[model samples]
Every structure is written in structure tokens, then in C-alpha cells.
Target: MRLSFPKLAHLDIRRGLMMVLWLQVAIAAVMIAGDWLGRNPPGAPSSVPGMSDPVAPGDQRRRFDPDRPVPRRDAPALPPGIDLPSTYPDRLTFERKTIEGFGDVLLLNGSIATGDADRLSSYLDGASTEDLPATVALSSPGGQVIEALAIGRMLREAGKNTAILPGMACMSACPYILASGEQRRVSPEGYVGMHQHYYDENLYMPAYFAVEEIQRGQGRTMEYLIDMGVDPGVMIYSLTTPPEDIYILLPEELLDSRLATEMLD
Candidate 1:
């Protein structure tokens, strides 16, 4: 006679499996919530991760809200002489504006969003030769970095020059567009800044994959900068700066890094 082992009850085995599945579901739900909160802080724009400064930030800084400041996400008032548009544009707006120094510039004002690049491209493609802008006048707090890169490349291919007027602030990804100019110009009081960028990632993606995505984005940005004739080494400022606060480049820094091909008096 052979000894036989007792079989576990099917109901008990099924219950154990159910418990494990429920536990996993609970864990995944918690992780997704946490990631959402981290990326979309209560006071910040849920879709935007902007670069700005409030009283020369150190470790903590307010997220840029070009439309208006939130109760908790406050940034410093614009410096003297700087002016926000009469009606702040929610999305990037490109309009022909005749300025004192830069003539017939496509005043690239308003907040840049994810789809702005395509809008710009479409507008340029449809414009007549007489209406095509030779200069892109930047006056933005900046928005999505990827879109900025795309816009910059388009500007480069079109052989457009970029400039920042005295009262305009070109913080965050706006500088990438500035770098694309064959003859970049920044006024003495123009605000051109940079900071770290945020890349979109799926909630359920592994940490390794997220890191890889970020690296790829950064690599593409660096490569784009080099292609635009700006030194990629200038990204050092971007890499070191916090995403919330912009690193205001010194006038000399702009000249030295070749980010500004020329200074506007």
C-alpha cells in the first residue's frame, strides 16, 4: 500500500488566490495615486511643469503660471518695465508685431503648450512670402520642453532669427527657441532663463523605463542645441537647476555659451 498526501480544498486555494489578487490591485491603485499627486501638485497647472523664479529661489520655487498666479503657486511680479499681454493667451500665439528695435517680428507671445509647435508649423506653411516672418520675438514663460525643441528646429530650418525684447521674459524652454536663431539677440533687460525639464511618463511604467525616457529626451535636446549652433555645454545650467526655478543666465554667460549671438542695446 502506498502513502498518499491529502489535497488542499479547492475553495481554500481559490480564496488565497483572490486575496493575493486584491492585495495587488490595492497596491497598484495606491502607487498610481501617489505618482499623480507628485506630478500634478495641487496649486500647479496639471498639464504644465514650468520654470520660473520667485525672489531668486534656492531649493523651493513656484511653478510658472503665465495666465495668473495661483494662491499657493505664487511667483514674483514681473520686473519693472515688463508687461504681461493685455489678455494673456492660454496657448501660444504667433502674431506679426512691429517693435521699436526688431522690425516685423512674429511676436511669439503667450504660454507654450504641447500642440503649439504644430500650430506654428501650420501657420508658417500657409503664410505668403510677404507675410513670412524673418524674426521670432520671444515673450513667454515657456511650457512643454519637447514642443519648444520642435519649434526651435522649425525656426532653424526656416532660417529665422530669434530675439528677446527688454520687457519680455523667455524663461524655461523658450531659451531653446532663442538658441535656434542664426543671429540670436537678447536685450539688456530681457529675461532669458533655464531650468530642468519634466518629461511625461506613464503611471505604471517601471522606474528604469522612466529614467530611460528622460535620458532620451535630454539627449535629443542636447543634440538639437548642437545642431542649432549653440554649445550643448550650456545644458549644464539646465541640468543643475531645479525644475521649479529658472537659472537666470548672466549677460556674460549668454555671450560665453554662444546662446546669444548678439546683444541688443
Candidate 2:
């Protein structure tokens, strides 16, 4: 007859098919495990990359959050200008009086204005020389030196008793006037001081020139006071000391220095 082809066994074929299926299943399992490991690794928390945790209501961060805007504070406005009064509280006043038997005790108020040289000269000329009265006054803030000196000379020439009322302050040129008095009186509150003679430079001249003039004027003033019988030492001390540091003499102190002939209560 004819040679027939040998047929393969069914069991061998089935075993080969089973081996192929097992290989495919193993490869699928390996791929699934790798994907799981990359997505969720061990020891790492599962959260969005940049997201922060929720904060408590009482936390400081919650109070002043960067995302929130803050309210601004308003400030008060300033006044446009200051309202200062023209007149000051303290003002000097001069009062005059007459003593019948004593001729006339002219209380040269520190506030009196004898005006310019011509006017002052006329006033002095008109004054009666026979019954020229003494001047009794208290002075603190000094005024025109020329006027003060003129009054001083007049008092000295008339031989009238010039008195500085104590508790009263005689300062600057005022002391020169006091020196003119034949008698100086100091009250409990009497004080005397001197300052460098001051003049307006802008109204006069350069500083050096003004200073020279002041010095000359001061020298003349000192000479007049000294010649009129004021102690040279006292005048020197006054000239040297600043106005603020001028001599302060009580009634007793003045009497001790011979600056005052009498002390009034």
C-alpha cells in the first residue's frame, strides 16, 4: 500500500499551547507591578506636590495672611499757622510823683522816652535847676545808654539824692543812672547786671566797626560812672560779667558792698 504520514500526538500539542499562555500571563504581571511602584512608592505620602496643609483659625498666619489685604491708619492734619498775640504779658510802666518839701521826687519810670538828643537836651534845660529833684526808681531791662548817662549826669550835678528802690532791678545803663544818685537804696529784691552794649549791625555797619563803636561807648559810660563816685571794682565787675550773670545784690549785700547807702523794707 501507500506510506502514511506520522501524525503528532495531541498531548504534546496541548502542552506546547499551555506553555505559551503561561509566558504571556507572567509578562503582564511584571508590567502591572512596575507601574504601581512608580505611582505610589514606599515611605512617601500621597498628596499634591505644592499644596500646603490647612491652618488653624487661631494661628498667626491666619491673622495676617499674605493673600489678604490690610487696612491703613489715617493721621491727623496740622494747623495752618500759629496765632501769637502782639502784646506780651509783661510790660514796663513809668509813673511820676512830687514831694513838696523835698522839691520833687521824680520817679523816673524806666519806661519813659526822652526821645532824641535835641529833645532830651531841651527837657533838661527847661527843668528848674534851683529845685532840681532827685530821681528814685527801679530798673531791670536797660534802654538808651545816652539818655541814661545824661540823666545820671544831671542828678550828680544837681546834688540830688538818687536812689535805687530795692526789690527793683537796675541793669545795664540803669546802674549808671543809679551811680549818679548821691544815695543808692536797695530793696530786698534788688539786683544789678550788665551786658555788652548791643546795636543792630545791619542798621549800622560791619561787625568789626560796630564792635569798635560799642567799645568806645562802653568806655565813656564806665568813665562817667566812675567819675560820679561809683566804685571802680563794681563797675569793672559789671562790665566783665554777662547780662545774665550780672551782679545780684540783696539789700544787705548791697549795703555791705557800699553800693547802697540805705536798705528799704
Candidate 3:
């Protein structure tokens, strides 16, 4: 006589099925909890232990709140201050501030707006009236790539060093300014990020033309990096990071990219 497996003791079969059902339920609960936490994550480090390299969505990330205005698609994951200027701030303004450890700095704050490049050039032209700051400190969410590039060239011409202290951010095209620095100093606590650049598309313009323009812009940027002594490889982060999220560079990446000559010890 042969014993069929399905005909085994009813009690034994029932117990095994119950155990599997409960295990599945427990797994579902854990996954649900993980997703909920991810919605409001405290942000993970750029380079986790045992990881080969630093990547996107790191310590600087925050939940995307619906209340915030999404400027360019390539804006930071964590929006800037509440009630702050989303578009161009009236204009990029400069203030003479004295920062600790770094001494006096010419603080450039607010969004980079149209004609801001001319404004910066004018500011430096009159810098002789007052004591010139050793460093040009940047704090902005970034705007107007063309303006940012122009400002960067002016900074490079001036031979000013750059620094970013904690409690402030330098992201997007702002890094171009940082790269222009004769010497770059950064505090790990300060946030520095990058993402793909966005250009306003004209309905009248053909797709191929738009693509060509973007390529030319990128080429100029790569050339600028080379001239600034920064590794063009750093653009890898900018290219890979999505427009919706910012890629916060780790201290190591900053050093490796030559974006920072030295960091807060």
C-alpha cells in the first residue's frame, strides 16, 4: 500500500500552513514600516560602510514637501528656506561678513538672477574702497547657468579663494564658483550638491537644435573645470543624479574631485 503525501495527518498540514501565513504577514508589516520611514528619511550618508563610492541622495536629502515650490526640475531634494525666493531673487547681493576661523569673507547670498554677472563685476570693481575679503563665500540654491559661469570667470580673474561654512549650502552651478577659487575650503557640515542642468526649451526650436545647445553648454563647463584644475570626472555625479533629487558629494568625493583644497579638520 502507498501513502499519499496530501493524505498525511490533517493537524500536521494545518500547522505548517499557519506558520507560513504568519511569516508572510510579518514580512509585509516590516516592509510597510520601512516605506513609511523612507517617506521622511533622516538621510543616509553618501558613502555607507563597505560601499565602493559615494553616490546620490545622501545626508543632505529631505522629504519632498508638496508645500514647497519646485523651481527648475534640477533643484535640491530638500527645498530652501520657507518663504524664500523661488525664482530669481531681485538680484544676487553681496555683503561683507567676518566668518570665524576663515576671517573676513565677501558673502554672496541669494539666487543668481539675470544681469547678476554684471552686478558681481561691478561689485568687485569697487572693492578697492574697502578691505578686500580673503575669501568669497557662497550661499545660494543656484539659478541662471549662464550668469553663474560669467560670475565664476570674474571670481577666477580676481584670484579669490572660496569657502563654505556649516549652516549654508552651495549647490548646482554654485560649484562652478567654488571651482574658480584659488583655494577651496569646505566644512563637511555644509551641503554641496549637483544634478543635471535644465534649459528653458522653446517650442519654436527643433529638438536637435536644443540638444546641440545643451551639449555645447556642457562642453564649455567641462572646459572650465579643466581650466580650474578640477577633475572633469566630477560631472559623473551631475549627469547621473536625476533632476528631481540632488546628489550631495561626500567629503572624499570633494577631495578627490579637487573641488576642495582642504576641509575642516
Candidate 4:
């Protein structure tokens, strides 16, 4: 008979499996250590250093540094007397007063100084066509021709019935304003007159500088009066006549001169 080897009884299947698992764990730990060593070698800058870095207090950018403390921003102070201008009264002024009972009767008194255009326009801001039953109580020595014309045109367009009140006088460009009214009336003492318009020739310097701006002004006045529906002869006579002769024409004289539609009783 052939010699047969007896079956080996020294192998333990469970113990062999445990030994294999231990070997795999050891290999994984070694691989992880090697990878860590490769990535961060010796002599590299430490994330957690042994010595702390100092920051200077005067440095502007120190607050922005991640490792440093942040600084607070200071706010600016406001200026003094915020409402000072409102407290002070205006040095140059124009007065536009409304008279009671006269209903829309606006009194314009003072030397029609500069900036009257804006002031007058503002005064009449709320006025409407129907409110034209209102009258303008004018007592101006005179003012800018352009501004006066603007006021006259505005009144005419509003269809305001204008009458130079009994005691008030309309002089210079003011007369043109009266002519613009649908019905022009005057008080017993209310004088309506015009003289040559004058400008400070010195203000214009070289251009339009003339001693005879009066004549030029007269021509402009005549043109404006005609456009405002005043008789051409009335305008011509008013402009050419001396200052003393510019009184209201008598009813007979007005009719004879074809200036009046009907004489005032």
C-alpha cells in the first residue's frame, strides 16, 4: 500500500483571519504617516509658532491684520449755527401788500428795484382769470422796463381789470402797465405820466452806450403802447412832451384827439 500523509491538525482558521486584519491596520497607519511627512517637511513655517508676533500701535494697517486687534472709526463733528441765515433779515427787499375789501387789490409800493420780476411773479402766483376782478394798487417810481412789461403782459393775459387807484400815481414804465388794462381809470389825484427810460450807461460799457438812450427808450415806449392798444398819438405826445405837461387830458381834449371812447362823467 502507498504511504499516505496524515491530515495536518496545526492550522486555526479564525486565528489566521485575525492576524491578517492586524497586518492591514498596521499598513494603513504607516501610509498615513508617510503622506503627512511628505506634505509638511522639517524647517517649514509653523502654523502655531513658539514666539508671538508683536504689532505696533501707530501702524494704519495693523487693524486689518487677521492676528491683530481691530480699531474703531471716529465720526466727524457738525458745523455751528445750522439755521443762522434764517435768523437774519433780508437786506434788500420789495413789499407787495394785499388790500382788504378791494379783493385781489395788490399794493405795489417802493422803487421797483432789481429782482422785482421774481417777487411780482410770486405775488401773483395763485391769481386766476376770474380773480381778475382784482385790481393792482400801483405806486412805483418805476423800475426795469423788461420787468414792467412782463407784469403788464401777465395782467393783460389774466384779463384783470386794472385801475390806478385815486391816490396812487403810475409813472415811467408804470404808465404802460395802466394802458394794458381793459379799462383804464385814474383818481382825481392819480397822475399817469411817462418820461424817457434811462439805464446806467456805465453798466453796459462799450456796447449800447449812448447819452441818447432816452430817445431809444422813447421809441420802445411808443411801440409798446401801440401794442397795448393805447392811441398812437397819445404815446407820441406823452413821450415828446415835457415832464410838466403829462397830466390827464381833459375829457373834451381826449375826445377831440380821438383818445377816449367816451368821456368820464
- Whole-model Cα lDDT of every candidate shown, in order: 0.74, 0.49, 0.69, 0.47
| Candidate 4 positional error at 258, Å | 8.5
Model 2 agreement with the true structure over 1-265: per-residue lDDT tens digits = 9776555444587787888899888776766565455433687543321112222222101111111111111211111221212221122333344433233455553432345234434555776664344555544345567767776776677665665443234655566677777887655434454544443323223344467777777777768857776654565555554332333333444555456677655
TM-score of each: 0.75, 0.51, 0.66, 0.49
Which residue pairs does candidate 2 place in steric collision?
139-169, 166-186, 166-187
The Cα RMSD of model 2 versus the native structure comes to 40.2
User: Which should have the higher TM-score, number 1 or number 4?
Assistant: 1
**lDDT digits (tens) for residues 5-75 of candidate 1:** 55543458778899899999998887777766665568734332344333332332335444432212343
Q: Which stretches of candidate 1 lie over 4 Å from their true place?
A: 1-25, 32-88, 201-209
- For lDDT, candidate 1 versus 3, the one ahead is 1
Question: Compared to the true structure, candidate 3 yields what TM-score?
Answer: 0.66
Instruction: List where candidate 2 sits over 4 angstroms from the true fold.
Output: 1-95, 98-104, 111-132, 199-206, 243-246, 250-258
Summing lDDT over every window of 10 consecutive residues in candidate 4, give the lowest-scoring window: 61-70
RMSD of each: 6.1, 40.2, 16.5, 37.4
lDDT of 3 by residue, 1-265 (tens): 9767764556587788998999999886776666445433677653322111223435433321112222223343321222233443445778787664467778887767779899888888877846678788877766677788888888888888998776456777778888889999987756677777655333333334468788888898899889999999999988876444566777889999999998964
